[model samples]
Target chain A: MSGCDQCALAGVLPPAPTADPGRPRLIAIVGPPNSGKSTLFNRLTGLRQKVANYPGVTVEKRLGRARLEDGHEVALVDLPGIYSLSPRSEDEQVAHDVLAGTMPDFPRPDAVLLILDSTNLGRHLMLAAPILALGLPTMIVLNMADDLRKRGGEVDAESLTKQLGAPVVLASAAQDQGLEPVWRFLTECGAAPSPVDLPALQDVPRCHAWAARLGRHAAYQPPAPPIWTRRLDSILLHALWGPVIFCLVVVVVFQSIFSWARPLMNGVQWLIAWSGAWVGSLVPNTWARSLLVDGVWTGVGSVLVFLPQILLLFLFIGILEDSGYLARAALIADRTMARVGLQGKSFIPLLSAYACAVPAVLATRTIENQRDRIATILVAPFMTCAARLPVYTLIIAAFLPERPVLGPLLGTRAAAMLGLYALGFLAAFATARVLKSSILKSERTPFVLEMPPYRRPTLASLGLRLLDRAKIFLRRAGTVILAMAVVLWIVAHLPLSAGKVPPIERSLAGTLGRTVEPVIRPLGFNWKIGVGLITSLAAREVIVGTLGTIYGMEPDAKSRGLQAALRSDLTPGGAVALLVFFAFAMQCMSTIAVVRRETGSWKWPLVQFSYMTTLAWCGAFLANRIVTALA
Target chain B: MQANVIRRRAPASLAELRKGEQGILDRLDLPEDVSRRLMELGFVPGSPVVAALSAPGGDPRVFRVDGSEIALRHDTAVRLKLRPAASAAAN
Candidate 1:
């Protein structure tokens, strides 16, 4: 009755009932960024939520089914956190479009659950006011109440409810308090009406002023000055100390990605090898055994072996992102990045690309400028991702001797590895500069970022993120990479030859490799290397597997035999050329697919692929010539 | 009193303030969307702001305002008109 009374007072009619009575009511959870909206959604939906992307965009749409206290179910959609309805960024536009019921895939929500941070009541309300004016059955959730209370701040929910004409609930999503009231309110509230002809909607200043006033009426008490935050920021944001600490943190993360993952990677490798051998014995037919063992097990397993490193990388990224340290890193890196025609915001995505480019490409969504985002994506793959590690380690082990460089502190092989990483970054920087100045030229947008107060990242959330990333990686391996592996296997085994020559040398892959060999020979790559290069397009790591399969060796953890064969087969110059080629080539199909999806065009991905391949060839030729001259 | 208030030198841009200085934000001279965004993040007129820390190269600095720290580049910070606090001026 009070909801309807408020609707009538606002001169708006209540929304009509759903066309299907049996269908569950739709509730949308919306809030500003870092307001704990996702935490609340997780609590409400638990494992019931489904993650998907909006049609034609990379923006995620998360929907879940939540059961109310009365055994009734309602559909809850977690919209992306946006500051206001006037959307500037694509992420903001998607959130705005979904809430306006303009996105065809999603219908208008029957009710709205607007989450507001109690600690920053005024700013949150600036966003809340626009949603409330939309005239839906809105409930204001004052989240982080526990944190507010700790700082001697209080919010009068009843007074806020009276002032805003919407039901307000004080909840601490992290502490899991005050959630039951949300379900009760949603169930009790019927179809909410749309606010019609609201004067505040037309004027931006009036809306802000009105929200500020409502914030006062709510008895909102601002939290005490964050002493701990200030103290930490003093050291962390220091002109000299900040960059040093950021570099150290990056070193630790990258080091851990390799060192911590080694044992687990070996375990995965052992399992794959054991299974491949097991399958080889079980299958009687040579072709069937080869397909199962070499195609699926070796090919997909080689890529999957990098999962531990990938998961570790995501975990570190999750902690950095959740604790709000990445923004500080961005601020520190902004000046250096500007020289390359990128803002500090591109720093995290480029750094993440070192772990894997797929997620890094997706992470570019945070960049508001379309041209900047595309430019960042265009150069992301050049950063030596974990996928390239296998090839690098293989080539280094085969070519470079393990001689101590810094009196046992560092070795020649280790130095070579560092050089490869540096090369990737140098290439990325040069590519970004070229792309920004030419193809994706735009005036620099003003850099403005909220430095969120640091908090302890919740283990539960971190674990969930790790699990989600692992799921996505495994899914890609199962689908795209698996299909590619099978196709490559068929190509490598087709037109069965009855001669003493190996099938791989006589198959379609062999002919294709031979055809391309002349073009690549200048770079010191033979037809076998050419074949490896072609299969590497599926994934960079697959080159190692493809080479193993081509050379008639088992691709597994113990790739020593393959390494020995490579050492005998390749000159040092050829080996360096191969490593250089893998370092710059746009070889990952997943990266290309994600780029196409992110840029919403085939044109950019094609350009990205061609330019990168050309760069790789040129770089490899130069490296080969230099090494050959030195030798 | 009115004459004295009028005679006070115009407020300096936020970019000119050294670290540890405090100022009251007068107005933002950025584009519409950007200024509105800055205001929404508690850069409203008359709010007390302190230059907290400068990043390496000192082009962008973190400013503490309304219990939140915001990072702004020099280009963006120059658009912020701020009246230095009397105590900060004395310091």
Candidate 2:
């Protein structure tokens, strides 16, 4: 089409609809891992995509609107990267279902965009062959074409297109080259041809041979590895140096999360306090004033202060994942993971659990084995997620002295924080071992992970990822945490009496706390702490907010900060016990709901909750006794 | 069959090969699902392979096969029978 004709067509179309009017023509993007499918999707859709879980499963699918040159819009889906059509993992199953037209929620695609890594064309086509045989109009994009050319490799796209009977485009997604050809092909390619003649899916060996034959027919030749890549792999994948470097990287990341985010956290806290004060002065009525300042501000502000730390944590994680170090880390961790009867692939999800169990549990879909996936999901919450950071920081700042443990290098508080994280990991490991030998016992699956070549992560992609994470966290705060805060405020303010007694002690939460007091007495918690613990079931971070509201509402405590109030009321032993209780407790309702949804049963979540609660109480009691004895 | 057996000694498992050693994959003595996955990752019979690197414990090692690096546990590696490459055998 001529440029003028295209412009005319674009102008003739009605104003673009805000949302898809009907079932828009579907175009699915499918590819193997590290083929730059996601990069291509990002280029095609920009910020117009929405990410949501598929119906009934926790696999995330990205849907966006792609406008053709004729101004006709089609729905573009970015499917999770998978190796082949044979469904081994949940993610692969989702991709397979959508292709087979079996997923009730998703329509069969009008075309398939099969992206292949030009540098590893042979293996990538093994996945492409099955997709092409499904009879959909397919366009093969040779991503990483620049990297191929730099290594003295050449691909004749014309010959490959003729051989496969599909349109082929050579593009470097990372360098942003050769995108116009893709759009042109999508706009011009109208009707899908009938399914190509292909050998039946008999066995793995047969599939490999077929793919190898296709590679030769297409004249696919992988480029020589760059000298620097070889040299770096020698050290990074070495037996002796690999684990050491990995441990050093982990240490640096954790230290950065603590030290780098401190200033930002303090600023957020200051802003919250300032706003609360400003709003407090405007509303003079005692009840409304207290509800606004003491209830909402103290409750929600405590959780909002943790946003900086969570962002920092995800930032480092994004770098590690994007730079391709996470795969190597998983390979190195496979040995230790095997000892616990888990596979190497479980490493990333479990490590991510340290950020938050909700996403970590969702990430378990990558594990192929059902038993292993469930095992990973079960023990994920044991890791100290970001929710516990607020509680740990509060307790450590209030109770633990900031004396240097390593003579200006590390402080006692830092050591305690690290120890808590280590404790979480140890508990998860032990739990995995026990569960493996008993209820979830199964044969060990082979660990075959593809280690992608490392590339410097682009700023735009990393910024987008960090922004996405921030959005999810803020959305949760806005909905679940905000609702819980309002409900908690009402609960802590009910049964108003005419006397001078504090409303918190006479409120519904007070009664509930007293009811659980006898059970928690041995753990060194009073009714107020018990109230915080009970409200924490909504979320672990809510404990901080709950305590803030409780202490904020007490008589003569309005001017004093929550931290100061906690220090005067709580003993050191009690603080340590509370911290230990929170460290192992399954206090996140969202985590529980995710587990139930993922496992397709409440049986597992109930079992998980009970066991974790038992462990938390026992650990808290021991911590209290030991600290009290030592003091 | 007897003459063919006498032409060469038994093949060595990948786990027994030291670093930098080369071998041709013979067969995998593993479960069907596991062996199938291994083959899909370019560990088919007659594929040339080299021991690339190992972890600290010397259990899970990275093996270079068909221009790609794969990490396998020692136990899994032992299940893959391989014939030592001619150059390595000659050396």
Candidate 3:
């Protein structure tokens, strides 16, 4: 393996993937939770990383090509952070599997970079015993060297290296300091190192004793944790002030997404319309021109218009998560969750579900209890995701006015949006209570969460996350929504009478919509609304795009905005029912597929879909009945 | 399920410790796997534990062990048996 030096010197030759035949030398980046592993991975790999899932599982597989200074390109995988090799949850199971070279598609690591936070070496050292036992060439990268130094913590790296029989490097990955040793280790440790005596992690008590003794022999002094965390916790986790502060945070996040993103969303909408007009002007107004302007532009643009709102949502969510505040919120929400038979850990996933259910379902991997995880996964889609924002915003803006209900702080529109969000949250809780008490019953798992020290989230990291999220959003708009739009346009114009387009009611798409209309008409939806619901099954946001394409094909609808076009066609009662339906319905195929893969069967997703759709039907019917009566 | 723990002997557990109080962890009176996890997190026997601020309803409380704050709910924390130490650490 050390012959990579010759491979490098073969002058402009591609670094041999000699280690794994086709794959580069695989090095697993292992760490304890919040051990600055990601910070280090990001620094080393920069943006060369590809984020994907392990084959058939929702667990993320983050692989990146890290160019060693010696011109050797190695593949670095960021394994799920775990306390030990003994698996406790699916996340730990995957990490353990990958490290053991049992995980499919991921080859055995030729070497390992074990990252442990330097400031908390006493406890973090427990990971070393299991990782070291694997007998791979390893480097103990003690991350957060700066924090340890600033807090007057001390560790004898020479003594530590001697005790652990592994090279130890003190590094502050964020500050780009003490990293030369890391580069040297990568090149130098190409050959397997001498195996050291290691305690099996399965004997947890013995393992801890071994780590504790090693720490003492190394003279590892745990850093003084920041004083401000306790001080802040006194107020932030206050009996009275905490809940109030949490509510205030949610409101502020909600209000800002609307007010801050309005101008941006409008800018996007204007750009989309301008481009459509520009493209339309150049080409003669034929069916091909219509396909480009009305079909592709309208369909994709309608979905694309919500990108600003989605970005803003992630911006706020990323801030909360990275700043360590979300951990506190989990603690706060635990009490509320308990009534529904879940713990605080479930709250984090449920909260993340508000952004999107896919990752939120993935997040349930942290929950140790199987029943609790299933319950959380099932209720995830009920937390109104960013995709639903397009539909909610369009309807609420058109139906509800801009007048403030709670003075200038809360507009009628924002209040209406909040009401819809609350509606989804309530439905989630009610469903969870039923599921927990009925079939998915289990004892409440121990809630043990490490409260990470609060740090100001860096803009570079936040910006990177936002960019990643934007890519996902735009990719969906380009692919699914674009294909659906084009297909819908063709269907709406089918059975061309005398080589001419027929009215929408006589077209294939319209006939299909009309067929489904009777079933949904009880909820006050027309055939167009029926069409939107049918397409929304692809993704929650596709309804907005479907409507955009549908109206774009109509002559009168072409003259006005989407919301304006919607208002003329839908009654206030129908609008409320549409909102309620989306709030409870499982509209995303991706989420269902993930549920299937995660549960390892279609049974749970089938039950979840049936249950949620039934709930949606009932809730939408009630809303329609009430709203129409009131109107 | 430990009968001795259910008998409620006099020794205080983490669930009973007040803010600013300190204790030494004796043994984890929990299921083997749960206790194993607790030990791995530096809650091993003879280690120091300092009480920290808790949540709003005070069910899940933060305890400082090995220079880190960990929030454990009463259901689990109550099972952490304590061996009283000589001096209480000043908060």
Q: Highest TM-score: which candidate? A: 1
lDDT-superior candidate, 1 or 2? 1
lDDT of each: 0.80, 0.78, 0.79
**lDDT digits (tens) for residues B10-76 of candidate 1:** 3487887778777888788877777777777778776678887878888778888866778888888
Candidate 1 per-residue lDDT, tens place, A548-570, comes to: 87888866424789888888888
For candidate 3, list the clashing residue pairs, or say none: none
Task: Give the range of the ten consecutive residues with the poorest summed lDDT in model 1 chain A.
Answer: A190-199
Error of 2 at A484 (Å): 1.1
Model 1 clashes, total count: 1
For B1-91, candidate 3 gives per-residue lDDT tens digits of 4864575443478888888777888888988877877777878877888888888878788899987889898888888988753332221
Taking the tens digit of each residue's C-alpha lDDT, what string does model 3 give over A32-147?
A: 98898988888888888887667655566788888998797877899988888887766789988887768876677777899999999888888887676666778999998898
Best by lDDT: 1
lDDT of 3 at A164: 67
Best by DockQ: 3
lDDT of 1 at B46: 68
Sequence-dependent TM-score of model 1: 0.89
CAPRI-style quality class for the chain A–B interface of candidate 2: acceptable
What lDDT is obtained when candidate 3 is compared to the true structure? Answer: 0.79
